[model samples]
Target: MGLFDSFSQIRNILKNIDLAAVHKLSQKVDLNKLMGTVSKMSEEDLAKMLKFMQAGSGDKRPKPEVNGDFYDLSKTLSAEEKAIQLKVREFMETEIKPIANEYWNKAHFPMHIIPLMAKLDICGLTYKGYGCAGKSSLLEGFIAMEMARIDSSISTFFGVHSGLAMGSIYLCGSEEQKQYWLPIMQRMEVIGAFGLTEPEVGSAAAGGLTTTCRKEGDEWVLNGQKKWIGNATFSDITIIWARNPEDNQVKGFIVRKDNPGFKAEKMEDKMALRTVQNALITLTDCRVSEVDRLQNANSFKDTANVLRMTRAGVAWQAVGCGRGAYELALKYTMKRKQFGRPIASFQLVQDLLVTMLGDLTAMQTMVHRLSQLQDGGDITDEHASLAKVFCTLRMRSIVDHARELFGGNGILLEYDIARFVADAEAIYSYEGTKEINSLIVGRAITGESAFV
Candidate 1:
């Protein structure tokens, strides 16, 4: 071979080598000696090597981002609101994305992020007074979407604390209770959890109230097992709902974790949202002071008020999960080569992307109006229920399509789509099952209860 041909062969081989591995090799080997050897190469060979290195090195096409807000819903926010939305997005991307898979794999919560998360000052985003931002419901919905976009488990954790638990106090607590809890919980100085679903009950929570509470003197005695209480295992306080056996009315109590009778055993082997520390709580003779009771929560009607508010947030979360999966799949298909070109160029693949985007856009628009209804004081139980029902069902379909696009990698946790897919099932089941939410809407539209 000619002198130049030999150098060209060496340069071709080097061009295909992984730069990351080459950099690591240079670190361990004598770098000076390596450069010394390279110095002897001809100017022509050197130029070829440098050119090939530049072509194959780390610079890549700008990564396709995972955003499902196709209609520019974010543009509707004011400048200040958009900045805050971006701030939360940046936090989730930088802090949570790196460790999310590790924590989810181990089924452990990263309590260390609490301080960092609290700094966002988003815990009580929608309420007025007591250190809250008093933001619009649309902004709150956007915040929920941003959290679930990166990790649904984290979103669930936030919603349980901010929406359900703190919301119980906001809507149902007395002035004294609100003054004491809202400020700290809003700051996330004290994490909270909602304890409503029970071991014997899941969907029929409103009427089935199996957990019982009885008043004795100044304290109320609570006895019941609450299952799937997200964040309950470590939350400082959990809002437990139990039926007043005397009146057959449901009431809410703030059960502190330190209380002797409030026992929380971490549930094990969950397939989805593993990073969320859900617990099977045994409130055996749990003693709660009347002062801790939610003074305004008169019955199941009151609990529904809280659910009616938070269910809209859950629908927003479903949009986030679907966005994560759809973005992953879109990026994957665009990069994955088959038949000598990117699969995303294929018609069928484009069809799938279109389908996923259609569903996502529909969800985004629905929740946007749902928030408007809430902000306008026109939101009803059935309105929230319908949004939850439609969004979650569509989210399941979107995730399934995204996972199918992955072929084998869809089930692998490393790809992140698997996490979204697994978490979608939990989102589908929780807050309220599709059947129940659908029945709620059915009753509203038909003026007939189909629940029985």
Candidate 2:
């Protein structure tokens, strides 16, 4: 037969068992029983069906594009913003994806990736001047999501540096301080870390900072310990928040790496975000020069302002983590076979997958608008707090569902969902725990603060 005749002959056979027919049969047959029957089919029948299935797919398999953005929220961004978003996505997939699990498993920071990441020029994305791109808050949120999609540890590391540490200065530092540090930090030449949560104080950091800062003639003597400070072990500069002994007001200082009495011990055996170099920082009469004091950070209110801004980005990171896990689970289900059928062909499995996608979509849409409010300058403490609470809650649910879909492989780090499952816990508790953030929104909208 001629090539065209053979092709036409195959097409005729393909039409007999196309995806549409298979989908209909799947609905009529009990998935478990149907799989058993397919497994028992004769070799000739199995081969013919497999060939028909492939041929029926033609050039387009009609596979649903694996996406967590159910409502297409990225459509709201402008073309330029979308381009930047895609650029960051490509960077994460190309640079971070391969090394993410390895570094995360070893609990080691990949130092070499820093300069490559810096070349992307995404740090201080929303800030204007100081060689920044001056993009909107939405773009920043997208970048956070992109990073977390591949590796949440890298996202958290970047967030601690660019959002919290750099933002603290951008929002509160004096003009000279801004001119001095913003440019270097923006270029990622000088990495940063925020030291706010102390060993004794976690969620209560606003009201209780055990770390004390006493002023001397030319420097501030800092004494106290900071716990779970991301990137602290090797960050070039750490923003240490401590209560002033004289005034009882919280203050911030740029604690340089070479401070004589400063020590940062790597926090080991973290179940989540292992790639992040979280440190239990110790300061024994660590004297930071007066020039290093954040001139405008007068109180805990200043610290809260920085947290308020970064909390929204954390919400977006949760979305990314959830979305990444969901995509992995969905793709696995579509390919993983049991008996003779893909596990995704089962109704119950599809239900779980759809549920995960729903949660992922909700989280994405919520953060999308949250960033919009921030860019509009209409964002309040409650606006960000609410997003943090909602998105993290949904993220927890999505990760759970995705993990369940993976069966035993879900717990295996090689599957990737295991990392998301563990990392989601840290994201849920960090910045502000769900309870703390909920009270913030409660105080704003209801005029009653339940927090004691």
Per-residue lDDT of model 1, residues 8-30, tens digit only: 65566567778998799888999
Per-model TM-score versus the true fold? 0.86, 0.88
Lowest lDDT 10-residue stretch of candidate 2: 1-10
Expressed as tens digits, the lDDT of each residue in 163-194 for candidate 2 is 99999999989989999999999999999999
Residue 116, candidate 1: how far off, in angstroms?
0.4
Give the number of the best model, judged by TM-score: 2
Among the numbered candidates, top lDDT falls to: 1
**Candidate 1, clashing residue pairs?**
none
